[model samples]
Target: MDRSLRNLAVALVVGAMAPLFDSTIVSVALHSLAADLHAPVATIQWVSTGYLLALGVTVPVVGWLQRRVGGRRLWMAALVVFLVGSVLCSLAWSAPSLVAFRVLQGIGAGAMLPLLTTLLMQAAGGRDLGRLMAVVSLPTALGPILGPVVGGLILGAASWRWLFWVNVPFAVAGLLLAWYLIPADGPRTKARLDVVGLVLLSPAVVGLLYGLSGVGGSGGFSRTAVWLPIAVGVALLVAFTLWALRHRGAALVDVHLLRHRPLAASASLLFLTGASLYGAMLLLPLSFQELRGTDALGAGLLLVPQGVGALLSRTLAGRLNDRFGARVVAVVAFAVLGAATVPFALMGPGTPVWVVVVVLLVRGVGLGAVIIPLMAVGFVGLERDEIPHASIITRIAMQVGGAVGVAVLAVVLQRGVAAVGPVAGFQQSFWWAAGLTGASVLLSLVLPGRPRVAAPATPEEAREPVAA
Candidate 1:
């Protein structure tokens, strides 16, 4: 990547680290949070649940926010919002207070997630997506690996409040870098927010996400909680589609952009990617604990190989995608991912630790390859103004897909375990993951374009207003 793109990636990634790590890192603290606040586990779970729900609701409106405030200012404002929320969370007096602060934190984080992608893609001007994704994927690839380790170390040595406090430095540093490195967007003084579209879309996303989350502990889709909100959410989405198609350029999220094949295909595959990747994440830890008699820490450490593999693969995948196109790269990537995942499905107690670790390394590479190409493709042919809308659409797809994946896999495991043993149950679940990934392989064929660098914009194109 060139220097400007590199700087933009660095600025965005640094700022993004706070929220990305904030999400997964908190998973380790749930039990302690429950005891310290004298709340039931169910009540305390909202600390995470509220954050995610707030995220779901907030993400759909980011396009309007970006147009109104400009990317650079919006980014800096979001950092401060997150920073203040983090500080309040550290001082939370009770479970209710913590959950409330986390919702605020989630709102800020929701804006940041899709905005980061928009800013980076804008800076690149559609050139070097493959190479740029390599740089952008650094924190993303590291967050899951580091989240547990960082959260575990802090919880081991200090009060659980430190979990919230830990985000302070990253927020501060990210704000500083963004202010210095990110170019100020020329404000679109005439732009107007799509109130009607936002009203319909925001709750639709939240309802769907909430319903998907319910699919886990309750029976999958068979229960009212899982099916009701989902049905309502889908209905709202269809309503928004009708409204957005009418508004066209004024829609809060332009469903019209789905006409772009690259964007549509990328969104589709990201759903499966989310399902497969997260489903495996759920199964891996449980398999280690139930089958291998490993503790939480040991199970997390076992996951290190997959993360390392992903890390090693990002640069290679990006380079290949830039050189070879997403189609060839994605097909091979999913195949590797599917093949690596199968070992877990077939593994017995007699399977060696070294063998599992080796397979995990290969699995990580598949993750690195599959995610970067899919993410990059959505913006491949998008106009400058359409990027923010595309970013929100893709992020929601991946998030919802992941929620559905985790919920589905959990249900599958429950059924499998009831029918057989824990080992057999886990293997069955892993088979589901592998099969889901294989399905993604078929979807990968629809992703657009040949391998080549994106053409740089001329000065005239650069000066044009980035509008729908």
Candidate 2:
């Protein structure tokens, strides 16, 4: 990578960290949020679910939005929106209001996430994708480690409002750095906005996610309420896929990209990876709090070693992916993840903390290794112009996988808790998580073999809007 591209990546990563960490920061504060707002646990969950749905709602339109407004301006604008929403969320007096403000925050966050990847790779001019992903993944590697600990510290000493307040400095600093260091947005010239396509795609994603999220509270997919939205969402998504197939490049998300072997494999693997990684995160904290009687902060602190392990592996994983290929690295990583998860699958309440800590550290390394490679390998053969489409497609897959994973596992966990005990509940969830990653080991076979040094785009291809 060129020095200039490296500098841009760093600046973009700094901005990227703000939205990336916000939800995770808010995760540990949910129980506190319920108490303070005097709301039922069911209602309070909207704080998280609403944010997730809002993300789904915004993601499909972002590729168009990125082109119409230009990425730099759109990013800054999204940050400003997030900052305003954060301040509003901090001041919310009720659960309903907090949930509403979180939606606003989520919209900004939704746009920011995919754009972060698009802007960085677009600037890198498609060189050394694996190395680029290594740098760009800093927030991903750190968020799991620091977010809960930070959230725990705030909730331990201060009001739940401080959770939203903490995002201010990062948002402000990121905005400033982006303004100075990032290039200005290119002129807006995009393929015509596909209104029908957007109508079908956006609501389809939002409804699917909303329905999946309801599965946890409703107990399972068997409930009418849980299944209804899911059925409708799936129908809508199927219709949209048909529409995209007819229109080809004119559709909103360009579903045609799935034909690319690397993109398809990477997106599929990301889906399962999201499910496994996210499901484990949900189970770990709640189980620690319920079964071990650890406080929120204490639980967060206990997970720090996992974060350390991920941080330690970042460079090594990136080098290996670039050199040896995503296939080998991803397969080995998934195997390690599945194997490390075994102890958790069998763990009891009295299982030693030292053992959990060791397992988490190793598991974190496997997760970090697999994710960085998958993120890079998808773009191996794409032109710079096609990146935004790939970005949206991959993001949607990963996000959907994560929400469904947590929901299904949460229902499973609840049942296990009712049947046996909290320890047993988490144990069952870990088994499911292990199974998810284990399946991905087979899916990894489809990833591109040892990557050949890719060809860069022509000068004109680099200049076209991402939607082009």
Candidate 3:
């Protein structure tokens, strides 16, 4: 990569890392936060839940906001907002206060997630999307691995509040880099804000996520608390879909992009990937903590092999996708993921730690391979103008799917633990996770066939860049 491209890559990766870090960091600190604030575990859980709900609620608005305010300005502004929220969260006096502040952080974070991809792709001018996405996605691979370790270290040496405080340097650096590195806005068109769509979609997302979250809580699925909001949310979302279809070209998400085979397939695979990846995420830590009697730090450290495997595979995965296409790589990767999960299903309290680590390492390689190519494939055969819309749709799908995965796994774990105990519960969850991975393998079959190599850009074509 050229220096400018390298700088842009660095900026995007650093910018993207903040939210991933926060997600993991907060997980390890949940118990500490609850104890310190004298809050029940149930209530303290909202610190993470609220953040996720807010992310789901706000993500849909990124494309519209980018068009309205310009990507660079919005990115920098979001960094500032996140920094402020992070500082406030560090000083929060109670669980509710912290949750509220986390929502603020989430609003900033939600925008950052989609914008990171959109902006980087825009900057790259579609020259080497597979490679760029791999670099951009490195943080996601690292976050699960490093987050808990960082959180644990802070908890051991400092206070839980430092977890929030730690985000400051990253956010500040991201803001500075974005202002300097990211290109200024191109010519603007007078695009109308999808206020109606936003109004309808935000609550729909929040309600669905809130309802799903309640599934594993005391109310369970049949309770009014669990079903009511989800039902309402689904109704609103369906209405929004109809409304968006009617609006078509003018819709916030541009539902027409679904007609693009590559984008659609990519989104579907993302859903399944989210189901498997995050479902396993929930099970893995709980298995170690609850069944194996590992503490937060130990559980976090044990996951390092997976991260290492992911990091090791990313460059090779990206290069292979560029050579062989997303379809082949994704299918094989998902299959590998499913195979890796089989070991977890068979694991017991007495299972050797080395065996567990080896399984995680294999699982990590599969995960690393899946994410980068799956993300890049969404833009295949898409026009430059359509990239942002595709980005938004895929992002929302992944986030919502992740929420579903977490909920489904939570329910599975709860029931499995109740009936058979923690070890069996984790094993059952892993089986379910393996199933989801298998579904992703099926979904990957629909992705576009081997990508045809583009002819090299001529001097004039290189000089006259296409707008993202």
Candidate 4:
């Protein structure tokens, strides 16, 4: 990529670090939040849940928003929203207020997530996509590695309020860089919003996320709180699918894009990869805490090897995707991920810490490798207009897949603990995660093999705001 594109990536990724880092940091501080705010853990859980639901509600609207206000303006505005929300969260006097502010933060985050990918992919114009995704995905790779460690250090030194305060620098730097570096808005389009599609899809995603989050507390899917909303979410999702199909290109997310083989395969594989990654995440810390008797910080430290491994593999994975194609890279990634997970399944409390660390390091490499291919492959043959929709679709697929994975694994872990014991329960959960990874390996075969070179965009196409 050129200097301009590189700068754009740097600006966007820097801004994105606030939300991504904020997520893992806040996760580590939940218990502290509960105690400090004098709220029940269940109530404090809303701090995360409310933000996630807001993200679900807002993510589907981004394509429309981007068309309305261009990527650059939309990005700055979202960053500002997140910045204000973070400050408000730091100042929060009560649990309800904190959760409310976090929802605001989520609104910003929801827009930023898809927009980040949309902007980068559009700027790159389908060239060097593998390399582009590696740079774009930096925050993701770092969040798991640095977020917890940073959170541990901050909480150890100061008040829980600093958690939100930490976001200010990233957000501010992102905004300043964005204003100076990102291209100005292009000519606006008058594309009409599909209100009907929005009405169906927004709630559909929120319901799915909320319902799935309830699984751990409800102790399986049998509870009304768990199944009822999920059923409604599924029903609405089906309705939106039918509506999107009928609406064709004008729909909120354009279900017709699934006709593209690369996107279709990528979307499907992303779902499974999401399941594999997030499912193990849910199980891993809990296993460390329960089996090894580590606290939250120690567990966080233990998982750093995985994140380091992932980080180390980013550039290499991008090169491999460009050279060998997503199929070869992904198949091997999933295989490695599955293999690494096996040690966890077999381990007892007596397993050496070094062994666990080594396995996580290898597992992180596999995890790192999985994202670049899945994220970039879908955009292989998409048009500029189609790129935004593809971004939304792939993002939603991974998100819903993550919720499903977390819910399913939580249920498995819960049941296994009841039926067998903690060690065995964790074993069962890890095995299930491995099984999902194995499935991903099989699905990887369907991805596009080795990318062909992209032609340069025409001057007129390059000047268009949407293309930019």
Candidate 5:
């Protein structure tokens, strides 16, 4: 790889890993945090949920923020905020305080996740998008795999607060590297901030997420508390879409990007991938811990095979995407994922351990094939100007879809478990997960048949004045 590509890869990896680390690190420490803080499970759950909510709320603004402040400055600032939040979380005296700090950390984290990709891809000048996306996605693929294992080790050897503290080095290192390595922002452009659109979009996303979260909580969908916000949120989103279209080029999210076939298909596929991938994420661990009698650590450990599979396939998937096309890779991958999930549907408490591992390995491979290409293909046909909008929309889709998928799976698993035994409950959930994966496969069919490869930049083209 060229030196610039190597540096970009390092930056993307470091930035992406920070959030993934937090997602998993906290899971192991949640019990410890609750016990030490004298908090209930319901209350402690907010640490994760609050962070997610913060992520959802803040992510939509990233495009505007990038344009307003510039990517390098915004990225470094986000890291500092995350570092400070991590420290506050470590020093928290109460559960509520910890949850509050986590939200702050999440705001920073949410911005960084999409920004890193957008920035690096911009720097690459649209060359090697597939390979770059593969590297960037490694942290995402590894987070769940390493999260539990690392969380378990930290819990075993240290206090729960270390989970937050563990981020200190990575954050510091990322900040330093970003400051030095990331190019200074180009000439600042004068653009309207769309304050009115911000007002409409923020609450709409928050309300929608809040309503989805409520579905799995005490209030069912019928409760006014549940339906009211959801209804309002949907209405607000529709209003924002109309308002954005009226404003045309100045709209906050540039809803016009959706008209691009590659981006639209990519976002839709991401939603399905989120549903199938994360829905199963909820069910898989429950199956191990609740039915198979594995402890949290053991379940996390067993899930490593899937992570390994993803890791193993990252380079290959990227190469395949570049060679064949995202359509071929994604459709086949989703098919594999759908098929792999079927064995889990057949799972019982007495299922063999080796069988579960093999199934997860297959699922992991499918996951690898789906996510990398889906992400890369979204940028296809997008002008340099459109990358940021595409990034923000796709990221939001993935996060919201994950949230919705987990919520739906929670309800499904609860009803399934209640109707059948614990083991059977997981099986039913697995079947549902498989169905979602199959839907993703169908969506993959709609992806652009093949992407046109751009020729290597000639010196004239490279030296030509660029338009942002």
Candidate 6:
């Protein structure tokens, strides 16, 4: 809210844009990339899959990295790594090379994502979180609006290489701003890496994510590739949970934090949010292209109204969350989201464009309204030291939940198409997505209501200096 916290947010948001933009932008270019590199679509898919898996492996390790290195240094260092990865990706000549480079980029992103929340929450000293998250959500709001459109335009005008080149400006600008704007952190803690926990958790995340990723391509969860890794991931996750319970505060993730009711509820709701948001994303663009015969660019252009709706709702949603608390806002938001999604389920091949666009706008508003409260509530009563672990917990929940949503919907879409027709199949999937969102409305009832006035900053928080 104050000048220093605002500046820190600006710096982090600028840096965060690289990954957020990179993911969506690169997705639009996958077909172009497959053709350019002379690779099969299946092989080229790794360019995205490898990055996601690498990201999953690295996320659980970030809380440890931040404690060891300090936030400012860790953030800037991760930015540098991402910058380098971007440059390498631009030069990649083969599919394998590109996938490897993306893995490097993912490692940098995994650290930055959660660390961004940890730094801002720490600096705010538990004050004005709803307002701060609005600022934090800016690139998130902008990414959907801009990333696909920008990718489409770039591919139209230039070679696919320009896609990677686009990140150069954002990364460079982010680095320069961070150097002067972000307050330097104090001495680092001597927290030891939980090697055993990392061994269990990181692989568990990769297996789960990788396994889920295969479900759609392999036709169903019945395939060995689809189920084997997932089974292993689930088993390892159970082992890690037991391990973390024993270690308590010292574990890689601190599974103990789930005992905090607000956090527990927020984490669960966040999983549903991830499912609704990403599952729909996969469906929307494809629906336009497949059923409406829109090209990638046209489909992207048609989706702009949704992005605009999300952007418009963000600030107001934050204010409402601050005033009425997460419970009321989230319940209404999810209800709106579910309601908007229903029209899509009923849409026919002859459905009017204006009708679809209007629904998307309403859907986007629901999307924007739901995020602020869920993101902020988990930290409400947490101690400063606990913030990093909480960040890790929420981020992982969202990521894993997203994978699950996408995988399940993909399978559903495939079977629906096989059993019914194409148009009918898509309708079935939309119904499923709407149902998942409706479930979130019920879950939101448990979120904390009418937030208390922020407690006074601790002596340590007060003493932490910032630039005037």
Model 4 vs. true fold: TM: 0.96
Task: Quote the positional error of residue 128 for candidate 4 in Å.
Answer: 0.7
lDDT of 6 by residue, 148-246 (tens): 888999999999888988988889999999999988885468988898999999999999999998988855899999899999999999999999999
lDDT of 5 by residue, 1-468 (tens): 468776867865785577778887797777788899999988998998798879878888888888878888898889999999999999999999999999999999988988987887677776676677788888877786678788888888888988888888889888878877777784356677888888888888888887777777654677787788888888989999999899978888888878776788889988888777777777887789987888888888899999988888888888888777788888898998899999998878888899999988988988877888889888865666778888988987887787678878888888877888788888888888888888888887767555554542664443222211
Which candidate has the top score in lDDT?
Answer: 4
Model 6 TM-score on a 0 to 1 scale:
0.96
lDDT: the better of candidates 1 and 5: 1
lDDT (Cα, 0-100) at 453 in candidate 5: 49
What's the lDDT of the predicted structure labeled candidate 3?
Answer: 0.83
Q: After superposition, how far is residue 364 of candidate 3 from its true place, in Å?
A: 0.7
TM accuracy, model 5: 0.94
* Candidate 1 Cα errors over 4 Å, as ranges: 452-468
Give the Cα lDDT of each candidate. 0.87, 0.84, 0.83, 0.89, 0.81, 0.88
lDDT of 6: 0.88
> After superposing candidate 3, which stretches have Cα over 4 Å from the reference?
454-468
For all predicted structures, in order, the TM-scores are: 0.95, 0.94, 0.94, 0.96, 0.94, 0.96
Q: Residue-wise lDDT of candidate 1 within 2-62, one digit each (tens)?
A: 8878888899898899999998789878999999999999898899889999999899988
Cα deviation of 88 in candidate 3 (Å)? 1.1
- Per-residue error for 448 in candidate 2, Å, reads 1.1
lDDT of 2 by residue, 166-207 (tens): 889889888998898889977567568988888888888888
Which of candidates 1 and 5 reaches a greater TM-score? 1
Clashing pairs in 1: none
